[model samples]
Target: MIKRIYPQIQGEIESGEDVLEEYSRDWSIFKINPSAVAFPKNSSDICTLVNWASLENKNGHRVSLTGRSAGTDMTGGPLNESLIVSFSRYTNKIISIGDKEATVQPGCYFRDFDKATLRKNLIYPAYPASRDLCALGGIVNNNSAGEKTLKYGKADKWVKSLRVVLSDGNEYEFRGFSGKDLEAVMARGDLFGRVHREIFRICTENKELLEKAKPKTTKNSAGYALWDVWDGRTLNLSKLIIGAQGTLGLVTEATLGLIIPPKHSRLAVIFMSDMKEIAKVVDICMKFKPESLESYDDSTLKVAMRYAPEMLSVIGAKNIVKLAYDFMPEIWRVIRHGMPKIVLLCEVAGEDEEEIKSDLDRLKANLSGEGFEVRLAATEEEAKKYWAIRRHSFALLTRHAGERKTAPFIDDVAVPYENLYQYLPALEETLKPYRKFFVYTVAGHVGDGNFHIIPLANLSDPKVRALIPRICEEVYRLTVEHGGTITAEHNDGLIRTPFLNIQYLPEVINLFEEVKRLFDPLSIFNPGKKVHGDIAYAMSHIK
Candidate 1:
């Protein structure tokens, strides 16, 4: 049927068992086998496929296009039961790089992009922890963030423009515009103009409601983000599309702004015995304006230690002896401190080495004055050891947990920094009842108050599987009550979409639906995501 309807397609369309099986699962807990997977060679092929899907839907055949890149999404955002449109196969490219920005295809690997930017002493700083495995499309779709987000903000802030193939089967460029530029766009009288005009109207009419619906957390990737579209003067559609998770349209190309990284950097490690002073610790750290503030619980540290041998593959260790030598100080510290309940890594970066070292010295003195075990990394190589644990803890659990697998349902919750003292304990209390079913680890961007709690569960056990919905309900309720968002970086895919209403009022949800219909009237894009996500359907598809 695909060959007949879109015979001009310049890429492969596979429905074979192996291909379908490969596209069935992502990093999330769900498993959904799409009918077929289409790899478009270029933007023209994507437009053709969109037009074909639209025609099929009009002919009483139900089909939709779900855009996917590296398939590194942890919320089932790239999974669909209809047709999967993967870009990594053919559409991957780094088109051009300038002094301040670069244009790239959706499927461009972040690791590759990072290397290119490093040559120019520039970086797209909103990359997630999965930088080695993720693609630009997933990063943009999820509005991704990482350690540097404390200073540089999320993907939405760096995205300068996007070329999206809308439900009308036409590609249009979207960017921020005001004054005569905005009027020129709305005056075109085409689908693009009509879209801008209608969206501007919707935003202007419901400005107060949209403002009220904004999440209080430092970062959010849950809903439509309609509140960020119009700020009275400039209307930026890219903000709405950045975190829409491909529900609005297929992003064929994107131009992202970049920043020059600091010339010198150092790390300050803080070992906390308990959560009693977490809020104070964060407050004190914020005063110094660290480039990155990250934390992980004792469970993650233990996992890293138990899988110590695996560190050689990730941390660039020369040999086991060298690895042990590099780890000797930390090992002795653990022996003396008996393992801290939480480990915080504060990175200070600047143009001058002495200034950064001075800053770290002052930070260490202040933290040590508070009676905390603080260690200042003497070199950049030493800092990598702490980062290895923070970044690869989830990978270690997923690979070496034997019968258990990574279940990231309640991951990516973020609250205000001031509430961490109470919110962290409440979150742990909520998860304590499920300790019998699974063991979990906590890690996140401490500066942004975002945490990723990944549970290792044996899904084969009925009791373990049954705990998913219950845990999601309880934890999400607690998150909302604490004035937080269900997701801070990972968007509302199949896992968190059903729980969006808990964080937003019904009226705002209605506006989200209205925006959905505005861009994807035919609902040919990724559905059941951002809106209309049925909990039953989501739970039934768990692997």
Candidate 2:
């Protein structure tokens, strides 16, 4: 019975069946199976497995608890059935490093915390292009961002405090305070001062309806960032548990906050062949404020040149005739300008290397005086093959989709960059009747008018799993009519938590179910993520 009531849980508590089928799949397309996984080895073995799953849910039993790490959650938010608690074997660690901050341990590894913040040159710039296979508890529960988050932004703006564990199993810590240290943390009466006096009285009586329910895009990890916790001068419940995917609890340490990049960088690479000139080349690459714009299409460069030597282990390419002689100038620009339906990439940094090559020669002469073509990665190994095809084109369509898979349901949508010239052509005419049932890929972080599409399908074809909620209700109703954000960095797990009221409202999803009953009042964490998700139990747990 859970190792005789958590006999000081040192770790490993399996329930076999190949550890519940490897904790029942993650990079989402749900599979669920958990029923005992536990591997904690710290935070007092996660407060004795959340006090033995809150005393096996006060005896009635269907107990819960999810927390996982490096399961690279694409939004199954560390899938759960009951009790999973992984934290990368022995709570990974790094636990300290300063001069701007570090702290670590949510099963560490964002490529080992970006090689320990680049040996003190400092970083942790909101990593995520599955930064060499995620962790740091899925980049602080998926508040993750990528391609240098178009100038450092997500992972809850570089965290800076957490620790967590709640649902009364204890372990507090959080951060951010203000005037009179937020009234001595809401007059410490306990349970972390009634969860900081009822999340500071539900964010000061819904401060202007949570600042008009934020998310005008440019990054959001679906719901319960309770409008970034009381902004009228600091209250920060670690900004609502940094993207609450762990469902308001089980964090187990993290501090973050770091920077110090730019010593000079570069990379240009455009190549459009027109998709209505991607909002006029993202409005002239936002007047050269680039620090990563990124893109990918042409069906992810024809599935990374039909798995060109399995992308020689992600753009390091030492073989396959030096990766087909470095993609022979993109196979002679697809036999002289023919296949480029999109391939941006921008980048641009500085501390002055001749003003980063005169801002990439005036951003390739204002994208060739608007006639467009551009191409400037003169090295950094020609910018690692456009970041190895924008970070391995969704792991090369989940390993050569011969019998399809990678269906990240409308994967991370995001809008508002002046409504991508009328929302990317009404989202490619609302997925043109599901492109005859599958085949997709578009990629993202184009300076934050995010995208990610994915698709691939075949979910053992139950009519292509009944067109995943009618293509997530026509691409989240055209991404909330272009104001966008139905996840800009993968978070409303189990498939966009039953479509968060198609991008919130209804009094901000009833104050996100009263901030999940004021911090899990017995819902026992990570249950159908971000408030009661269902869509027929997430489409009968699609796989």
Candidate 3:
């Protein structure tokens, strides 16, 4: 079948074990060998392939397609038994850079986009943990957010427009609709027009319910971000597609919103004894409106210490103090002497240095009564060190887990910011029964009340594997009880799809299905993900 369609596409298409093996699994525990892999060089190439896949073959089966970026998705979004459209290999290119926006191919790396925007004195703000490795396509698809979520917001906030291709080969550039554009959309009789009309109707009809269901947390990337489309005025169709995880359609090109780079920035690390004090510090840091606030538990820091030197060497020591610490063994004694059980890392930034210092001063004054030790990163390198602890903590856990691997099943749960004190303790107690089998560590973007539980379980053991559903159930129950989201920034792929109904109302889930059908009638694009799948399907394939 691929050979039949090969003449139409202007890119590479291959099958067999060697090609199939590359697209089999991603960073997640799930693994499934795809039937074939297609490397489409451009949007036209994608359109042809999508149209071919949508047609019924001799076997009366339409080939399914899944757009892949980086293949570093931890939720099994890129794991499926279908034709993998490997976007990152050839489609990675920054098309254009404007004053406050940049149009880029979906395959462009987040770091590369950041570098390109930084050169123009602008920035694309959402920085997930996989900032360097994750591509723009995956980030947008997942609506991923990182430490800066509290301030800069998620991928949805930065997406200005999208050039998308539907499963039936129809191409459309989605952007915010003006009154005139909305009228024009409603008047058209074409497929794109019909899509717009249905979306507009859904957005308008369910405006109140959508707004009410919006999570109070700082970020969310769960089932279709339908609520973000209608803002009381014009409809922003791009927001709906931003976090659909490629189940909606193939996002070939994206014009991203950018912000002016901050002229000055300062990061501070605060140490507290327990969750209560850590929560208090977070409150104070939030009041200061830091760019991002991250938290690391004692277990996280201690684990990070095991890999600190190696990470420091990679980050590079620019000053004598850092150089001495790198070369001198005695420096560890002083550093380890006052390490606290919990740490909160915060960053404040603006164009003015004095204003940032004043904010830092105010933050310190507010935190004085908490008995917390505040350490301002004196140099940029020191700041990077503080941030690295939060950035690379997950990797450290995975590296140190020797025989076991870090399972991300219940890792990105988030609750209301005020309920962190209640959620963390309850979550810890919930996992107590399986503690003997799994070694889990907690770290997260604390300002937004989101945290990750890096559970190091030997997945090969049947007993350990059986406990996954129970662990997920307890954690999700606690999250819902606290008015939190099952997934804060990571979109619901195979991991959280079954639980999506638990998060939203039945009507909303129905609407999600309708939306999926409206865009992808054949369900060939990344099937068995998000809105319509069960956890058993995902759990069964855990490898």
Question: Please, what is the whole-model Cα lDDT of each candidate in the order they appear?
Answer: 0.90, 0.83, 0.81
Candidate 1 error regions (>4 Å): 1-7
TM of each candidate vs. truth: 0.98, 0.35, 0.94
In angstroms, how far off is 277's CA in candidate 2?
Answer: 16
Ranking by TM-score: 1, 3, 2
Mind giving the per-residue lDDT tens digits that candidate 1 earns over 105-183? 9999999999999899899988999999999999999999999999999999999999999988899999999999999
Deviation from native of the Cα of residue 501 in model 3, angstroms: 1.5
lDDT of 2 by residue, 1-543 (tens): 644554358777888899889889988888988877888788987887788777778887768888998898877888888778888888888878888888888887788788878988988887888788888877887788889887888888888888898888889888888899889988987777777888888878878887878888778888888778777788888888888888878999888888788787888989988777687788888788888888988989888887877775666666657655777888799998778988889888878889879878987998899788888878776688778888888887887787788888888888877788888888898898788888788888877889898889889989989888988888998888888888888888888888898888888888888877778878888887888888888889887
For model 3, how does the per-residue alpha-carbon lDDT over 347-420 read when each residue is reduced to its tens digit? 99988999998888778777876666777777776678767667777766766777798888988889878888
Candidate 2 global lDDT: 0.83
| Model 1: how far residue 507 lies from native, Å | 0.3
Task: Give the number of colliding residue pairs in candidate 3.
Answer: 0
Better of 1 and 2 by TM-score: 1
Candidate 1 similarity to native, TM-score:
0.98
Q: Which ten residues in a row have the lowest lDDT in candidate 2?
A: 1-10
Task: State the TM-score for model 2.
Answer: 0.35
Each candidate: RMSD to true structure?
1.3, 21.0, 2.4
